[model samples]
Target: MKDQHEPKTQSEWQTNLEDIGAKEGFYEALGDQHTALFVERGDTLIVTFENLDHVYERGADRMPWGYDFVTSRGWSMLGLMAHDWTWYRDSEVHDFFDRLRDEGFFERFSNVIFYGASMGAYAAAVFSSAAPGATVICISPQATLDREVASWETRYKKAWRRNYHDRYGYAPDLVADASAVHMFYDPRAPLDAMHVALFRGANIRKYRCRFMGHRIASLWLQLGILKPVIEGCVANTMTQAEFYTLLRRRRENGRFQKEMLQMLQKLDRPKMLARYCTAVLARRRGPNFRKALRAAEEQIARTNK
Candidate 1:
């Protein structure tokens, strides 16, 4: 609803999650501790890690926000929201997942899809370990923000202070038995790419979304393939080819067109930039493409001179 940025304060963010959960008939559990909410609407449950910023921006009217793309397929929703990148290390958070396992909650569902990006992505990968046969979709997920383990990763320096050696600490170690883990990250983002490198196992399939940086999920949301891909995961039909086919929508998407245009310009590939702009222009009339086209043409004119 509002521009989707991380919320500035926890009070406002928590309030927003509560408000939306209430309006959507989603019951809350341990909100003060880990802020978990779930709606039991169907046999298939989609467990998602909702960052505070995303919830505060996308309110209740748009029920099941982050998983909006896939939730429409009639799957129940379980939301495990965090205050920050708590890495879900809190005792309460740990106990919550343990209790779920003790109570056999996840097994009740016919299928479970755990999803998140960045900090939440780390949590998704970590906690999905509780459900042996669930599907995992992590976008720009960190293997661990722990400085000790990820000392090579200089990014998220603020998160380094947290202790990542505790239970469910190492993200890669957590998903040993998941049915399948799909990791997406941009190689251009050295930190994210490095994090992807940590998650190794026969079950893990890493997809490189080059140039799409740490917030690739936001970019895919613009391209409109985010939902279809996740839905395919739930349906057990999302192959690498199907995901790429869905990603093809980016060819006409304004965000992808502009990102590619900017990169091509910086790379001094004027001819390629012009070609990209012309292709996008033929499909849609937009200011970004028009301006990029002009810039690329000007660069070409200078080059020819």
Candidate 2:
């Protein structure tokens, strides 16, 4: 048998949760497919969804997404981890939420926020229905993988086999009663935009992150705007203006600029590429950007000749 200190199994992961300073918490298996790790702290609760493998491989600490960040602020956390990309479509998971609602687990909290990204984002949005007035902050979420509903969604083909037409199926519909839903997605991603279109509602605030791709959360983290943005949303203090201001930091992000340059090159937009590279070079010295600039200049000179 492996040593107790080595967190190689789900049970061990649960054991490690206790070491992370949970004032009052419990880790329960929602089935073989999902696990719930609840850490009680203050009046505010931030429920997060993530892949089980992701949580395990996240870092040396092996905590859930934003676990430390939320806990340090004296907030509670209930993290749902999926064993795979199940889109959290399971009877056990549904019953767990039902039980939480029945017990009024959410009512104890003065404020509750459901947060996640990508596949996890879909789970966060759909499950927020368990706590009707909860605020949902989902990045690059899909409305539903149902064939009839989101037929345009060609991604997550493996998840299409799961029943999305059932309970907690349609994320957009389930999150309708939420007090506020903050959705962040790259408008340039066609499928993601289509998914965003399905989430239309007065309470839904759509933040278009043009070039950030589907992994907006990771990109925002790299840009150093993730913590503040999440804090603002959790505090109900995030405004459209404020969010855009924070997103402005992406202009200086190396990954963002690199991807933008690549996109420009792929589209054969030498003029736009030249202008973009010139702006990027003005501030920072990037070997890739310099090479791209030189190529763009050569293309421009050739075209002019």
Candidate 3:
């Protein structure tokens, strides 16, 4: 496959697609082949493989793109699309990566940081495991397919079983082989918390947060969590201690305060909202923080009236 970055025009893009189809055997077989390039001054490249299930619908914009955060740090971004809620083996995804490897796309880069949140996290963990010495960061990852435990299983029953046979699921087995793995989860989310436990024996690090929710970790991109983690991975100096500190700080420092306040207001829980906002404001003191607290207060006052 040619570098998707080389396609400069409509005709060029079409021709590139045709070439990829020819090389890969069929265009329709490319389950989720969306690629974007961000050029920056750096020797390290971050290849973020997004998870399955409504990726194009929900996560296309959420996953770190546009190089806003990465470019400033002098690192480039490569985003990969997965099989979309369907269970696919690492070989299937690596087939795409192998093509890029053969074309010398990753050769110029010195360090590669593989990141994904949720199911995408599963993909990142699986793909990075195959590489000799690659760093992987997964947030709210599912270690195995437990139908009774996974809330999303009802929506993705076929995909879950298809990926996991009678014995093991993807992340639980693949994580053992990774060079370094960082798994993050919220203790409140039982499924994700259980998923974090599967990486106990390997070079895996675990982080547990309170009330941060499943998607909170991926928001690291927006909340400024990706920078330090990516930098640490590249420099080989990142520790779980530092990673958790960042996670905890982001949560307490007004990252989820607004959303929690909104939820509290909608549920007509003014007292809870006030208490939560008070705690957040106490830790995070600033004009903007106060503004958010006042906004929550206004919502509570309005709802009561």
Candidate 4:
């Protein structure tokens, strides 16, 4: 049976949460939330470093990509939600991890998977060391936005203000002891790709998600492969080949199909474009592909003249 730290009433829970997120530079459910409730339910736990915007975008009710997969079977979730992209370096934040370690929080779970995307991914990689043998699945995670180490990262300049040399600063160094580190990012996103390149070590498993943009997590979710990929990561069984095979599902994804059409049209091979579009239109009826097929036919006519 799974255990839960049930509050007596919804209002009580709301009141409890209020005392939690009211401080500046302080975060949501950080120091005040019940740590026991955080990992009380299951043998498997998913730790996520999240931004407040994500909560606003999806609403707090929406679970992160991997949480739903393990909930039915009994798994715990600890979302280290940041009020902003603070890079998770506050003194209280470090203290929270200290408490968890002293209490042997990681020891309670048989298996744990730490997950996040972008800045959150950076935090996951850095914090994974706390759990020693746990798996870390991060998408487009920065190695360090610290100006000293990565002045090339012109984007998120605000994050550079925070000190990355602090306790859990360098992500790559922090993740060395983890059982496995699975990082996904698009080689086309120069900054994200550059960041991933910096996060190198023998323990890392790099998954190249070409042309997917910096929102690799969003793309995976759109293609309906996010959950299963995370499940594989948690179970320590997901491989590069398996990830690509699952990626084949993107063949029907509207966004991918549209991007592919644009890429093909950019090649200027009207003849081949005509054939590819005809083939795609025959299998699936996409408005964008059909329009491209028409445009390709016109281009061929113009070329033939």
Full-model lDDT for every candidate: 0.77, 0.88, 0.61, 0.75
Off-target runs (Cα >4 Å) in candidate 1 are 1-33, 59-72, 284-305
TM-scores, all candidates, are 0.83, 0.93, 0.62, 0.82
Once superposed on the true structure, which residue ranges of model 4 sit more than 4 Å away at CA?
Answer: 1-28, 31-39, 60-67, 265-272, 298-305
Greater TM-score among 3 and 4 belongs to 4
Which 10-residue window of candidate 4 scores lowest in summed lDDT? 19-28
Order the numbered candidates by lDDT, best leading.
Answer: 2, 1, 4, 3
Candidate 1 per-residue lDDT over residues 123-210, each given as its tens digit: 8998898888899989889898876677888766656777688778898989988999999888888888888988899999888787
lDDT, model 4: 0.75
Which pairs clash in model 4?
A: none
The total number of steric clashes, by the backbone 3 Å criterion, in model 4 comes to 0
Q: How many clashes (backbone atoms < 3 Å, residues ≥3 apart in a chain or on different chains) does model 3 have?
A: 2
Give the TM-score comparing model 1 with the true structure, all chains together. 0.83
* Top-scoring candidate (TM-score): 2
The C-alpha stretches of model 2 lying farther than 4 A from their native spots are: 1-11, 18-23, 56-60
